[model samples]
Target: MSTDEEKSSGSGRLLTGVAWAILLTGLWLWGRGAADGAGGASAPTTGDVAAVGRPLGVPLPPAREPLAPVGPSRVEIPSIGVSAPVVARGLDAAGAVEPPPFATPDTVGWFGTGTRPGAAGAALLVGHVDTSTEPAVFYGLSAARPGETVRVTRTDGTVAVFTIEDVRVVGRDRFDARKVYGVHRPGRAELRLITCGGTYDGKTGSYTANVVVSAYLTDARGV
Candidate 1:
């Protein structure tokens, strides 16, 4: 691996809804609450927001056949200047997918119990938007656009090259885990990078929405 580096809450209503929507997936129980500013220290919130739906007249590459499941060891998004190590993480006591500890804000966290990157499913990775004092690894994630490339190096020594297809800042009022985290293409290998977004609310001490960057495997190569 290599270079780079970046939650929220609201009322309890947001937590319950996020938790429930994720449960419906049944593949991985990554309740948004895990990214909901758990263990937060109040850095400036992530304000970059947009949802560039697939553009017309731009043909993305076909999905490559999924490789044998293997854990990711590192990730890179050159467009956004992201290059960082990826560590396995599990569900927290709250049952939501946990992010890396606050002390290591530059590292990315993978859902250890879920689909591995380059496998035939959506592999989930998360990172902090900010800490008590500064921006974290995924601080610029929402700035990524479709057609951009995200490379994930796996334990098997393969680099999964995923082409970004969608970038959405899902608001609390419109959060949907199945739509946000579920596999977009059933047979394709997918990857999702998530973090807190929207305006930070002092009332709840969390962001008002989440930024989700969705992509699929278009190519793969040796490390």
Candidate 2:
């Protein structure tokens, strides 16, 4: 429900296979050759690139009982020293979740129409890794380690505390919408923090992959 400063910025059965092929083809076109051109100033290392697609190793905790849904107002990651205001955002014309604008690069955007932070589903929060000129709110998001905590304060005066379970980079080519954005476990409240990652192509002006941090609600307060 908050406003930002002025700035600039499915399916089943055998028929699903055809849809997937088309989608994958589109991703390849949009992100092709992203891995090329090495030795650039900011090119990610081979280790960094390889780590993005690795399976999660963090142990999952016992699923917590569900809580009432609450609109998130802020997010904090103590280990990473991130504390930022949160604004609700909707899908863009491309049907992808839109992020906060460059003008307010420090703010985090929550997918308002989806699951709320403390509810029994995966609540998504996204931000920019960097703007055209400099690093943004989630610039250091990839450095966050599993087992760290992400706290979300809600408009209803509640705080949803989640524990990091996994952190992985998903290349546009290998992106799986259901896995990346779907609920990992039923009856549990989860949170996903995402931002662009992988190689940045100056020619195309876009990142070739996305960084995703997965967590689940472990505690709550002020309910």
Highest lDDT scorer: 1
Instruction: Please give the CA lDDT of all the candidate structures.
Output: 0.69, 0.65
Per residue, candidate 1 scores C-alpha lDDT tens digits across 1-223 of 1111213323321112232223222224333332221222111224333464557776778889888888899999999999999999765555555557768889998878777888887788887777756778989998988888999998888899999988888775655455567666567788888877777655555567777898999999984
lDDT of 2 by residue, 116-154 (tens): 888876777877776545678888899987778899999
Q: What's the C-alpha lDDT at position 209 in model 1?
A: 75
Each model's TM-score? 0.77, 0.73
List candidate 2 segments past 4 Å from native: 1-61, 93-95
Instruction: Give per-candidate clash totals.
Output: 10, 0
lDDT of 2 at 166: 72
Q: Model 2: how far is 34 from its true place, Å? A: 29
